[model samples]
Target: MLIREATEADWPVIWPFFHDITAAGETFTYPFDLGRDEARGWWLLPPPDRTVVAVDEAGTVLGTAKMNANHHGNGAHVASASYMVDPAHRHRGVGRALCEHTLQWAREQGYRAMQFNAVVETNLPAVALYRSLGFEVLGTLPEGFRHPRHGYVGLHIMHRAL
Candidate 1:
């Protein structure tokens, strides 16, 4: 597999899984009925911010990630990132590769640390992956996320120094 910068053309392929994942209401906070244009605007960030895709040898996109400042001005030194892997591609290291790529990008860009503002506590795979990558749960906001099937669950604030 190869990791490379994402392009506008990749949105069409990404939308299917992106929509499926968000609509599941299991992890991401995006509205279940989020539209394509709105999602495109949110995922395809502009310069200074970065978006990338993990593709197979045949060039099939397996996953994607977007990284940027967690906050502006005085808070810009800290970075944040989001990842989405094709459900069909889970457990194949797609998510991990995207995360590793994002971390490298953040470090190269001079970020002092990386923080995830709203990680659903129930997303065990993600929580484990982040932990394995050296991120720690700083705290959890109790009943912060209203999971579709699990009712209210905590949202973990995870962080790690670069």
Candidate 2:
């Protein structure tokens, strides 16, 4: 798969699954009621930040990831990111590829570290993936998220040095 910068044209392709994933209220911190315009504004970040799409040989967008500084001003040395894999394309290593791409990008950009501020604790596959990629859970905020079915659950703050 080829991972490349996303364009506005890609938003139509991304929004369906994006809606499903966000509306599911299982992983992301985005509000469940996030609408198209607002979601687009949130996901398609501007310069100095990067948003990429992982596409198959046919150019089908399999997943997307957004990478940026974890904080502004004095704390900008650290990077942070978010990912979303098309539901139909899950389990095919798309997420891993997106993640690895982001790591490389962060390292190349001279980030001191990469942190994921709010990984849902019950998202086991993602937590395991992050662990395998060398991210450590710095801490968990007790009852940080209200999972649709699981009630309140912790949100893991995971990190890894570049």
Query: How many residue pairs of model 2 clash at the backbone?
Result: 0
State the displacement of the C-alpha of residue 69, model 1, in Å, after optimal TM-score superposition.
0.4
Candidate 2 per-residue lDDT over residues 50-158, each given as its tens digit:
9999999999999999999999999899999999999999999999999999999999999999999999999999999999999999999999999999999999999
Residue 138 CA displacement from its true place in model 2, Å:
0.4
lDDT of each residue in 92-158, candidate 1, tens digit only: 9999999999999999999999999999999999999999999999999999999999999999999
Global CA lDDT computed for model 1: 0.97
* lDDT of residue 29 for candidate 1: 90
lDDT of each: 0.97, 0.97
- Taking all chains together, each candidate's TM-score versus the true structure is 0.99, 0.99
User: Which portions of model 1 miss their true places by more than 4 Å?
Assistant: none
Score residue 125 of candidate 2 by CA lDDT.
Answer: 95
- Backbone clashes, candidate 1: 0
